[model samples]
Target: MPAQPFTALAIGEAIRRGELDPVALTRQCLTRATDSDAVFISLTEQRALVEAEACAQRQRSGTLRGPLDGVPLAWKDLFDIAGTATTAGGKVLGKTPAERDAEAVRHTAGAGMVCIGKTNLTEIAYSGLGLNPHYGTPHHTPPPTSSEHEHESRNENEPRAPGGSSSGSAVAVAQGIVPAAIGTDTAGSLRVPAAFNGLVSYRPSQARHSRLGVTPLADSLDTIGVIASTLEDCLAIDDTMRGSAPLVRAAAVPEQSVIVLDAGCLDDPRVSRAVGDNLEACASRLKDAGFHIVRRRVASVADTLEAITRHGWLGAAEAYTEYRALLEGPDAEAMDPRVRKRLEAARQMPPDSVVSLYRLRQALKTRLREELAGATLLTPTVAHVAPLLAPLEADPEHFSEVNLATLRLSMVASLLDSPAVALPSGRDDDRQHTSLQLSGPCGEDEALLRVALGASSALTA
Candidate 1:
């Protein structure tokens, strides 16, 4: 009878108290999603209602599976949901309904979470900008109370990039259609969208979770992750997907050391004044909160960038290999032209260069791990806030430039196989959300997440 709680954990708590019906909550989410455009590739109404009913029965009988049981979530279309087409934001892929759920989906279902639907993404999850010419792009509509002054200065209807390849996942949560969503990050898919939409995203080390049944862009770099409204929600979904009970909560802000990378370390000219200032302010807040803040350059960070500059993206070369058949086949005509161009460009990378990049990545991973021994590294999630969509959509060159810039910072974590969390720091002068990323050594996901909880609290406070 009352309005449904807005977060997954809160909804689960209400259900536990016999204060909310999972069936009613599912229907409410379905209704909201049905009215949205370009956010969902397809709705799993029958499946969601069925799952919610079972969860309700479990709660009634005192057989609840976990804390997130009965919570609704959207999966990026790259993940296979039995009986739903896994479009991967392409006109050509997943024409037939998948026969089974992705490994992550199966785990979440095992925890009793409901699948509301599949959200749109960059075609083949290739671009940083969440544009899907085939499915349309989902724009982030700033909440009315977000910033009244900024709303009056600019057209509220002006289209901006939603950050992709998890574009719709972020927007779906931002619009309050669902509490959380599953997405993948090869370079920066999950974090970029979260940054743009003012949400939290966690990209775990590639080895921390199962990737089975999920579509792959680059088997080497692709990682499945969660996008949600808070760091706690991200952690809960992460635990469920890993087949663990949701036991991790934002614990006491642990006394930890945090390394703030020098702004000059990025070597990216596109890094904006607003982003830099906000990152510094966040560092100041953390320092004030008793975090040992060390400001210096990380050699591994510089080395990784140099390797990328010399060899190009290792993922691009791998992606070309994964989809060469489709890219060369006649069906390639159906692919987005921008995506096609980027994939084709990888063809120019020599075989030896790809191998060298792989070797460099392994070496850098070790270097990064040794550099941060239980300490967290903080950096800007992206060099800038979401850019206006119209200009980028209208020019392929501009699109490519912005896409590379958007992914610059996130690629560092991917290459190092490090676990990272992107948290909304504050709004820019334009009132666009700016984000700060906290990352740590590879395979140190839990530790980094704990540190992030503390960092997030300090920054938001």
Candidate 2:
């Protein structure tokens, strides 16, 4: 591997400078994707080559589309890609080929990004653990020369859980198969996988991007996002998907307030000591870089947890309603038993309770915005690093517990409809990656990204 992996923007610049060939780049990506170990459910070989060829011609003509003109990316299988089926990592759903590209797909294609393939995910994107019974789960083993290998025995290479339901997308980028991949997050799907794999993920406000042509797991909470090698790569893809001009990078505002959620208040035994330590280290870095760090309990966090305990996960209730027929239908047996069980459990949630959860979500969102008061909220993205895959695969009960715990913190941002960025904080003594999440008020996607950029730079520096 190269000392510095190519980012989407770097690839585009190389193409423009005649240092790279779009067609050749696309072919190389396609070749690598062949050995992705189930990372891709299907590859768009013909379409990608055709797009690459056109991009090459445009490059020669000096009429490139944009900064990411010749970059190659993978989409989570949930997005419609014209003739390919949007599998959503299930054998039963999306059996037929789509007739048109999804709205987000069209936007990226319009910006000249090559679509290498559709990546795998949890069935219907329902789990954060990233284990897929139908398609093999995607896992990342760090390179021997990487920091992960420095502190641990070679045994650390054991296959571990790839955070999901965006499992394949995160693995693809982490393995350098693609600079960036698009995925959906309802309850930390994108961020969890990225956190586990030591990458960056951005979950924009739900309404920030068009969800058309995308499969629905939970209508209200389902959000399209990107997982990539860098914050710049994530922001560039975000711009392309939104069909907006690139956002100008700005320096961290002087004395900008960043609220570090007090770990003591969480009182969750599942939160590892390593996660808390890494979060504090990250907070210290930001403080050294001139950001105002405030440590206190955010009332909204506690309130959201209490409300969910009282009512239940709004997304689960919504997902249950979305797939109730499939769960009850004759085809139910064909689905992943784990995913099926989860969706079916929502049946016990009374309809009135579901309604109350929705109402509570709105109230919580309002309270959260006021509490945040323009200061970004920083918390551990997941309570712990990714767990080993064997135990999770062998014990379904263990899987359920870890899955809920892994999604706990990220779910708060989802329930409140806040835009969030998950950054790789640092590796633990065991060489596992820990993640820090920074979220801002709903609809403040740009501001959140800027803060994330500053935080990322501070940590990396």
- Residue-level lDDT tens digits of model 1 in 410-448: 899998888999998787756788888999888888878
Query: Model 2, poorest ten-residue lDDT window?
Result: 140-149
> Model 2 residue 152 lDDT?
68
Candidate 1 TM-score, C-alpha based: 0.96
RMSD list, candidates in order: 1.9, 1.6
TM per prediction: 0.96, 0.97
TM-score of model 2 vs. true structure: 0.97
lDDT of each: 0.88, 0.88
Per-residue C-alpha lDDT of model 2 across residues 160-210, encoded as one tens digit per residue: 899999999999998889999999999999999999999999999988899
- lDDT, model 2: 0.88
Q: Which candidate has the highest TM-score of all? A: 2
Off by over 4 Å in 1: 1-5, 146-151, 155-157, 249-254, 265-268
